[model samples]
Target chain A: MKSKAKDLTDEELHQIVEKAKAKDNRALGRLCEHFYSKIYRFIYYRVNSIEDAEDLTSEVCLRVVKSLPEQKGLFYAWIFRIASNMITDYYRRRAVRSNVTSTGDLIEEMVDEKRTTGELLEQQELRQAIKHLTEEQQQVIVLKFIEGYDTDEVADLVGKSAGAVRAIQFRALTVLRNMYVRKDGKS
Target chain B: MEQNIELLLDNCIDEIRKGKSIDECLADYPQYEDVLKPLLQLAVQIENLPQPNPSSEALSSALINLGKEMERNTAAAEISEAIVPSQRDVLPQKGFAASMKKRKTFSFFSEGSFRNVFRKSKLAWALSTFLFFAVVLSAVTVSANSVPGDILYPLKLATEKVKFFLTFDSYGKAELRLNFSDKRLNELVEVLQQSKTLDTSLLKDMLDEAKLALEENEIPVEKASILTAKLNHVNAYQKTVLENIRPEVQATDRKIVDDAINVCDMRSRWMRRMMNEEYQEQYDEQDTTPQSQTPNRKRHQPKRMQWGEGCDWMR
Candidate 1:
C-alpha cells in the first residue's frame, strides 16, 4: 500500500530536529510519527525480522534523541546516519546467531500475511520473483518503491552516489518487470 | 526508443501512486500489456504481504536507552575534571614528593681533582694504573736493548725452509732420482703426483728415487720426514701397509701426510699472532703503511666515542 504524503514537509522536519535538539519532547514525538514507518520498513528489509526491525527502528529514534543535544540538528544526512548505524549493528548481532541461515526467512516473516485467494496466489508468485532478484536490486527497490524515499535520499541513506542509486533502481525495476511480466507462452 | 516499456512502468508507478490497487500496476505498465491482466493480479497478491509496522513501545524504549547513555557520558566528563589536579592548586602531589626526587645531573666531570679521579669506578682505576705502568715499562725496554730467543732458532727456521723446499722439484746425479727426504726429490714427486696425466707406475719409481735425498745420502732419524717421503714416494717400500694394520695405519699415515702441512701453516700463523701481541707497536713502527688501514673502528662507534675509552682490551 502507498503511504499518504505527510502534512509536514522536509523543511518542517528540519525545524522539528532543531527543536528536538533544544529538548522539545513534543517536536521529537512529531518527528517520530513522520519517519517511524520509513525507519521500520528500511530495517524490515535489511534485517527481515519483526523483532529486530522493531528493536532497530526504536534504536534509530533513540539515537536521534540522544545525539540531538549536541547536534545543531541539521539532520539531512546525519539522522539517516544514525539509522544506518542501528541497521548495521542489528545485522552484526544477527550475524553472531547462526550463520545467516536463510536470506529469505526474515524478509518472508516481515512480509507474510493472510490475504484473499487470488491476491495470495499472485503474491506468492511475485514474492518468488522477488526472491530471484539480486540482493542489490532488492535493496534499491525497497529503498525507492517500498520506503518511498526519493532516489537521492535513498542514495544518501545507502551511502552511494545518486547516479549509482539511479542505475541500481533502473536495473531493479527491469528485473521486476521481467519476472512479474512473464511474457507470452512461457513462464 | 520503444519508450513503450519505460512508459508502461511509469503508468504502473502512477497507478500505485494513485492507490488504484496493486491490481492495476501491471495493466498500467504497457510494457507488459500482453500479459498485464495476469501480471497485475499477481502484483496485487504481492502488495498484500503484511508489512508489520514496528510498535509504538519500541520507539519509546529506544528513547529511554539513549537517555541513559547520554547521562553516563556526562557523568564520565564530570568525574574526569574532579580527578585531574591543576598546578595552581597548592595541594602537594602524593605521587611525586620533592624530598625523594633524584639530584640534578652534572654537566661535566671534575678534572685533575683527587675526589674526581678516585671517584672513577674501581675497574676504570685499575685499568688506568695498569696501562700507565705498562706504557712506562715498554718505553724503558725500547730505550734499552733485548734479544729474541736464539737457541735452536736456526734449526727451527731450517726445518721450515726444508719443508717448503720439498714442495718443488730439482734433479740429482741419478737419472731417475728418488728420495722423499731430499728437497729436490720431494719437489719432483710433488710434480708427478700433481700431474693430471701420467703413467700409473710414475709415483712408484719416484719413491725409489728418494733413497739419496739426505745430506750424507743417509736417512734421517726422524720418522715424520721418512713417512712424508713414503707417503708420496709411490715406490719407497713394499710394506703394503700390512693389511692387519690397515685401518689404523691408513688413518695415522693419511692424517699425517695430508693434514700435517695445513696444521703447521695454521700453527705458524698462530705463533705470529702471539708474537704480534707482544711486539705489535714495533711492527707498526717498522711498516706503518704497507697498505694504509682506513681505521679499525666498529661501524656502530659514534663520532664522539673515543677508541681508548671503550676499547675491548682496555682491561
Candidate 2:
C-alpha cells in the first residue's frame, strides 16, 4: 500500500514533525503512519508474536505522540530508542507472565506453532540466532542488513563510529555463520 | 590488519549493495574469499528474509490509538495550563477563591483550603510515603539476588540502570558497569547451576557491560590500570567458569556460550595489553602525555588465541 509518510522527503518529514508538534492532528497521523510498518517490523523481528509486536508498536506510537514536542536528536533514532526500550519492557512483562527460563524456550514455542512452515521456521530460527548476539551486534545486523541501511547510516542511527559499526557487523555475521554451519551439520 | 579486513568486508558489502553477486565480490579478494564467503552469504540471507509489513488493520488501529493519545495529551496540556498559577491569578482578588470554591476548580490549590487539607493529611501522607519507601527498599533488596527468569530480576536491572544514570563521575560509571557485568555473570552461573534453561541474553549483556566499562575514558591512568587488572582477574574467572560449563550447555545454546567465551577471551587479552601499555608509559617518563589522555592508537584489538589445553574458539 502506498504510504503518505513513506513518500515524504527529509524536509517534508521535518515539516510534518514541526506541524505535529504544533498539534496538527493530520500531521501527527501522517507521522505515525509513516513509521508504523518499520517500527512494527523491527519489533516483530525481536518478538515472536504478531499481537505483541502490534501492541508494542501502538505503545511506541503513543509515546512518540506524547513526547514529540520535547524530543531532540534524530527523529528516527529517537523512535528506535523508544521501540528498543519497549521491547525490553515487553520481555520483562513476558518473563513475569510466563516465567519462561530462557529465550531458547520461546524460540521453540515459535517453532512448534502450527502455522510455522519450514521457511517460516527457518526465518524464526535465524531471528533467534540473531538475538544471541550482543545488543549492539543485533542493532548493527538488523539496521545494516535487514533494514538495508548503509554502514554510515547505521552508525548514525546506532550512535557508533562507522568503524565500530563495521566491526560489529563482521563479528555478528561471524557468529551467525557459525550458527548456520551448525544447523547444516545437524540436518 | 584486522581493521583492513573490516574495511574489506565493508567494501564487499558495498559492492553487493550495488548489485554485484557475492561470488563476484569474493573473486575480487581471493585471499579473503575463505573468510568472507560465508559471512557474505549470511548477510545476503538476512537481507533476503521476508520483509514483514504491518497489516492494514494494525496500521488503522495504531493510527486510532495515536489520535486518541493526541487528544488526551491536548486536553491534559490545556488542563495543566489552566491549573498553573498565572500572574493574573497571583494579583489580589476578592471573589477568586470563592468562585473557585463554588466551581470546585483546581484553583483551590492556591487557596487556604488546600493547605488546610494538606495540614490535616500530613500524618497520613508521611505514613504513606514511609510505607512506599519501605516497600520499594525491600523490593530492591530482594531483587538483588534474583536471576534472569525471576519475577524481581527486571527490577534489579532497572535499579542498576537508574543507579548508573545517577552516577556522574566517569570512573564511577565505569566501575558501576563492571559491577553490573559481574552481576550478570553471577546470574548466568546461577541459572546454569539451577539447571534452568540458559539465558544467552544475560551472557551477551555481561559481555556488553564489560565492553562499555573497558571503553570508558577520562579515568586516571593508574586507576584505569587497576581497573583493567581487576577486570582481567574477573574475566579469567569468567573464562574458567564458562569453560567448565561448556559440557553442560544444551546443543542449541552452545554456540552462543562459545561466542561469549570468545568475547571474554578477547577482553582478557585487551586488558593485558592495556596494563602492559600503562606499565611501559610509567617507565618512559620522557613521554609526558598521560596514557589515558593519549589517543588510543589501537582502535581494534586482535582476537587472542583461545584458552590452552585443547580448548579451541569453538567446536
**Top model by TM-score, which number?**
2
| Candidate 1 chain B least-lDDT 10 residues | B298-307
Off by over 4 Å in 2: A1-6, A96-116, B79-315
The window of 10 residues in a row where model 2 chain B has the poorest summed lDDT is B83-92
**How accurately is candidate 1 docked according to DockQ?**
0.13
Q: Please write out the lDDT profile of model 2 over residues A61-172, one tens digit for every residue.
A: 9999878889888888888999999988887877833311245534544555444556666776787787677767877887787777788878888888999999999989
TM-score of 1: 0.39
> Chain A structural similarity (TM-score) per candidate?
0.69, 0.81
lDDT of 1 by residue, B1-315 (tens): 334444454456457656775455554345566544443443334344555466656654554454344334433433344333222222222322231122112111112222322333334546667878898556544532211233443443344355446644322222123332243323323433454222223223333333233222222223323333333332222223212222432343433222323322333343344344435544564476556655332211111212222122211
DockQ category of candidate 2: acceptable
What tens-digit string does per-residue lDDT give for candidate 2 at B1-315? Answer: 778889999998888878888888888779998899888888888887766676666776776566446545544443344333222322223432333233332232244533433343454556667878999999999999999778998999899999998998767998898899889888988998897568777787776687677677677655766777877988888888888888888888787777777767876887787778767866676377676785444322223334333223322
lDDT against the true structure, each candidate: 0.46, 0.73
Residue B86 C-alpha lDDT in model 1: 23
